[model samples]
Target: MTGKFIVIEGLEGAGKTTAINTVARILNQHNIDDLQFTREPGGTPIAEALRHIIKNGLDNEPLTDKAELLMLYAARIQLIDNVIKPALKAGKWVIGDRHDLSTQAYQGGGRQLDKTFMVTLKEQVLGNFKPDLTLYLDIDPEIGLMRARTRGELDRIEQQSLPFFERVRQCYLEIAKQDRTIITIDAGKSIDDVTKQIEQILTKWLTKQV
Candidate 1:
C-alpha cells in the first residue's frame, strides 16, 4: 500500500508537537503500520547535529541570513533523502512536525532572506518530495510566545523578538494562500478542540484520498 505523508507546520509554540502526537495516535488506532513521525533539521544523525548548530551555538556568535537559509535547506535535503522519502516509499504514513514551510517562514519571512534564492534552492534541493498534506497551525505570535515561555527555557530561535515572529506568521499566511495542499487550523483553541478538528480533517482526507 502506498503511504500518505502528512506534514504539520506552524510558528514557534503553535502546538504542532501536540498535533503530531495526536495524529500518530489516530493512525495507530487504524492499525496503520510503519507510521513514521519526524521533525525537520533533525531527522537523521548528521542533520540533527546541524540542527544543534542552528538551534544552539556551535562556533559563530551571529549567523548571517544567507547562512541560516542555506543550513535549513541542507538539513532538508538530508532529511528528505535519508528519512522522509524512504518511509513513504516503504508504505509508511509519515507525520512531520515541520518542513519546508519553516524555511520559507523563518528564512524568507523572519530573516528577510532573498525570495528568489529560496525558490531556486527549493527546486534544486527538494525536487518532488512535497508533502501530500500540510497542516498549518495558525496562532498569534504573542500567544505563541506566552505558551512557549510557559514551557521551559527558550531556545535561540524561540527567543527571537516579536517582530521576527510577526514576520514568520505573515509568511505562513502567504504560504497558505499560495499552496493549495495546505490546510489552516486555528491554534488558539483548547487542546481537545484542536485535536478534534485535526481528527475530522484527517478522517475526511483519508476517506476521500485513500
Candidate 2:
C-alpha cells in the first residue's frame, strides 16, 4: 500500500517547524514508524542548491519573479522524484514542510501573478499528486513578521514587504476555504494550545481514514 503524504503550510514564523514536530509525535503515538520529513526548495542535493539561490539574493541582481516561480517548481519536482515518491511507494509516510500552496500564496498572490497561469504550472508539474492532508497555520502578517525577525536575519523571501505577506496570508485562507484536505489552525495562540488543536484535527482525520 502507498503511504500517506502530509504537509504543513504557513507564512513565515507561523510555527510550522513546531507543528511538524507535533505532527510527527502524534503519528508516532499511532505507531506510524516508517516516516520521512522534507522541506520545500531543499529536500535533496540539487534542490538544496536551488534553495540557496532562491533564498539568497544573487550578488549581481535580484532574481526575477518568473525565475523564482520556476525554480520552486524545479526544486519541488526534484524532491518528488528523488525522495518523496520513492518513500511513498515504499509505504513510508512523508511529512512535508511547505508545498505547492506556498507557490499559490507567494508567487500567485503576493507577486500578483496570474492565478490561472499558476494553476497551469501546477497541473503540468504535479499532475494529480497532492497531499493527503495539509495543516495550515494562520497568523497575522505583522505578528508573524515580528516573530520571524526575532529568529534572525530574514532571507530573500522573508524580506518581502508587509503587503506581500498580507496578500500571501489572504491567498492561504482563500485556498484553505475550498479544500477539505487543508485544515486551518489559528497559530496566534500559545504553542500548547496550537498543539492541542492540531492533535484534535489529526486524530479526527485519522479516525476517518482508518
Candidate 3:
C-alpha cells in the first residue's frame, strides 16, 4: 500500500502531542511502521526558520497578519516539496502536527484575513494536496490557554485573546463538519480517554484501508 498522510490538529493545549503519539503507536500495532513525522511551518530547514519568526517574532519587529500567513505557506510548501512529498513517495506514512487547516483556522479565522485570498493562495500553492486523515482535538479556549500557560512561555500566536481562539475553534469545527476525512475528538476529556478514542479511530480506519 502507498503511504497515507495523517494530521493531528487543534488549538494550543489541545493535547496534539499525545494524540500524535497515540496515532503512531496504533499505526505501529497495525504493522504500518514506516512513519515520517512532521510539524507545520517547521519540517524543513527553511520552514524551521520561518517557524521561528512566526512563533517568536524576528527581533520584536511587528509581524503583519498577512505576512505571517504568507510565511506559513512558504514554510509549508518547503516542507511538502523537500520532506513530506519525498517521504510519501518512498512509501513512508507521513504524520503531521498541522497542515493547511491551521492557516484556514488561525489566519482566516483568528486573524480574520480575506477568505478569497486564503482560498486563492491555498489553491495556487497546495492545489489538492491535503492530509488523508485529520484528527481534530476540540477544547475550550479558556481551559486550553490555562494549560498552555503552565507550559512556560506563550508564543506569538499563543498570546492571542480568548475571542480570537474561540473564532479559531469555530472555524475548525465548520471545516471539520464539511470534511468526512476529518475526525473530531473531545479533548476536554482525560488523556487516557482521548488516547482510547484515537486508537479506536485508527483501528477502524486501518481496517477499511485493507
Candidate 4:
C-alpha cells in the first residue's frame, strides 16, 4: 500500500519540531517505522538552495513578495517531484514540516496577495496534491514571537511584523475550520499535553486508515 503524507504547520515557536518528533515516535509505536522526514522549501539539493535564499535574502537584494511566493512554490514542486512522491511510492510514510497550507497562510494571508492569483497559482503548480493530514499548532503571535526571540536571530520571514504573523495565524485557523484533514491544537500547553493530543489524533486517524 502507498504511504501517507503528514504535515506539521504553525507559526515560528509553535513547537513544530517537537510535534514532528512526537508523530515519529507514535508512528514507530504503531510499527510504522519506514518514515521519511522533510521540510518545506527543502529536501532536495535544488530546493535547499532556494530555501537558503528564501530564508536569508541574496545579499542585500530585495526579495519581492510575489517572487518570494513563487520561489516557495518552486521549491515545493522540486521536493514533491524528487523526494516526497518517490517516498510515498516506496511505501515510506512522509512526514513534513510544512506544506501548501503554509503558502495559503503566509503568502496568501500575510502577504495580502490577491486571492484570485493565489488560487490560480496553486492550481497551476500543485493541482490536487496535498497532505493527507495536517497538524497546526496554534499559539498567540505575541507569545510565539517571544519564544522565537530566544532562538537567536530571526530569518527574513520570521522578522515580519507581529501583525503579519497575526494574519498568518488567522489564515491558519480559517482554513483549519474548513478542512477536516487539518487538525488545530493549542501549542501553548505543556509538551506532554501537546504530545498526548497528537498521539490521540494520530492513533485515531491511523486506525481508520487500516
Candidate 5:
C-alpha cells in the first residue's frame, strides 16, 4: 500500500502544533504503524537551519515577497527530497505540520506575491510532491494574533502587522476553496473539540484509504 501524506496548516497560534501532536497520538493508539510527524522549513538539519534564519528575520534588507517565496520553496525542495519522499518510500505515513500551502498563503496572499510565479516555481522546483490531505485550521486573524502574542516571543513572520495576518487568513480560505483535498476546521473551537474533529476526519480518510 502507498503511504499517505497529511499536512496540518494554520496561522501562528492556530494550534497546529497541538493538533498534530494529538493526531499522532491517536494514530499510535490505533496501532497505525509506520507513521512520522514533521514540520516545514526544517525536518532535517539544513532545512531547519534555513527555517531558523528565515523565521528570525536574518536577512539584512527588507525581505521582499518574492525572496520570501523563493526561500520557502528552497526549504521545500530539501524537505521533500531528503525527508518526506524517503519516508513515504519506506511506507510510512508522513504527517507534516505545514507544507506548500503556507507559501501560497503567506507569499501570495499575505505578501501579494504573484500566483503565476508560485505556479511556475511549483512546476519546476517542487514537481510531484503534494500532500494527500491538508487540514486547514481556520481562525480569525485578530484572535490568532492575540493568542500568539500571549504565548510569548513572536517570529519575524508572526510579528507582521494585523493587515498581513488578514491577508494570510484570506489566502488559506482561498486555497480551501480551490482545492478539494483541503479540509477546513474551525480552530476557534476549544482544543479538545478541534482534536476530536480532526480525529474523526482522519479516521474517515484512513479507513477509506486502507
Candidate 6:
C-alpha cells in the first residue's frame, strides 16, 4: 500500500520544524514507524544546491522571478521523484516542511505573477500530485518576521516587503479554504497550544483512515 504524504506549510518562523517533529511523534504513537522527512527546495543533493542559490542572493545580479520559480520546481521534482515517491511506494510516510503551496503563495501572490501561467506550470510538472494532508500554520507577518529576525539575517526571499507577505498570507488562506485536505492552524498561539491542536487534528484523521 502506498503511504501518505503530510505537508507542513507556513511563512518564515511559523515553527514548521517543531511542528514536523510533533507530527512525527503523533505518527509514532499510532504505530506508523516507517517514515521519511523532506524539505524543499531540498532533500536530494542537487536540490540542496538549488536551495542555497534560492535563499542566498548573488552579489551582483538579483535572481529573476521566473528563474526562482523554475528553480523551485526543479528542486521539487527532483525530491519527489528521487525520494518522496519511492518512499511512499515502499509504505513509508513522508512529512515535508514545505511544498508546492509555497510557490503558489510566494510566486503567485507575493510576486504578483500571472496566475494562469502558474497553474499551467504546476500541471505540467506535478499533474495530480498533492499532499494527503496539509497543516497550514497561520501567523501575522509582522510577528513571523520579528521571530525570524532574532535568528539571524534574513534570506533573499525572506527580505521581501511586508505587503508581499500579506499577499502571501491571503493566498494561503484562500487556498486552504478551497481544499478540504488542508487544515489551518493559528500559529500565533503558544507552541504547546499549537502542538496540542495538531495532535488532536491528526488523531481524528488517523482514526478515520484506519
Candidate 5 regions with alpha-carbon error over 4 angstroms: none
Q: State residue 206's C-alpha deviation in candidate 3, in Å.
A: 0.8
The runs of at least 3 residues in candidate 3 whose Cα sits more than 4 Å from the true structure, single-residue gaps closed, are none
Q: Give the per-residue lDDT digits (tens) of candidate 3, residues 15-107.
A: 999999999999998898999999998988889999999999987799999999999999999999999999999999999999999899999
Candidate with more favorable, higher TM-score: 5 or 6 = 6
Model 4: residues >4 Å from true position, as ranges? Answer: none
Clash statistics: count for each candidate: 0, 0, 0, 0, 0, 0
The parts of candidate 2 lying over 4 Å away from their true place are none
What does candidate 1's lDDT look like per residue over 60-158, in tens digits? 678777877788888888888888888888888899889998888988899897789889898998877699999999999999999999899998899
What's the lDDT for candidate 5? 0.86
Which model, 1 or 5, shows the larger TM-score? Answer: 1
Better of 2 and 4 by TM-score: 4
lDDT, candidate 1, at 184:
93
Candidate 4 lDDT by residue in tens digits, 29-147:
99999999999989899899999999999989999999999999999999999999999999999999999999999998899999999999999999999999999999999999999
Using lDDT as the measure, name the better of candidate 2 and candidate 5.
2
Off by over 4 Å in 1: none
What's the residue-level lDDT of 64 in candidate 5? Answer: 66
lDDT of 2 by residue, 55-94 (tens): 9967768799999999999999999999999999999999
- Go through the candidates in order and give each one's C-alpha lDDT: 0.87, 0.94, 0.94, 0.95, 0.86, 0.95
Residue-by-residue lDDT tens digits, candidate 5, 126-189: 7776899999999998898889999899888998888998999998998899998999999999
What are the models' TM-scores? 0.96, 0.98, 0.99, 0.98, 0.94, 0.98
TM-score of 3: 0.99
* Residue 82, model 1: Cα distance from true site in angstroms: 1.1
> What is candidate 6's lDDT per residue for 1-210, written digit by digit as tens?
259999999998899999999999999999999999999999999999999999996675788999999999999999999999999999999999999999999999999889999999999999999999999999999999999999999988999999999999999999999999999999999999999999999999998887
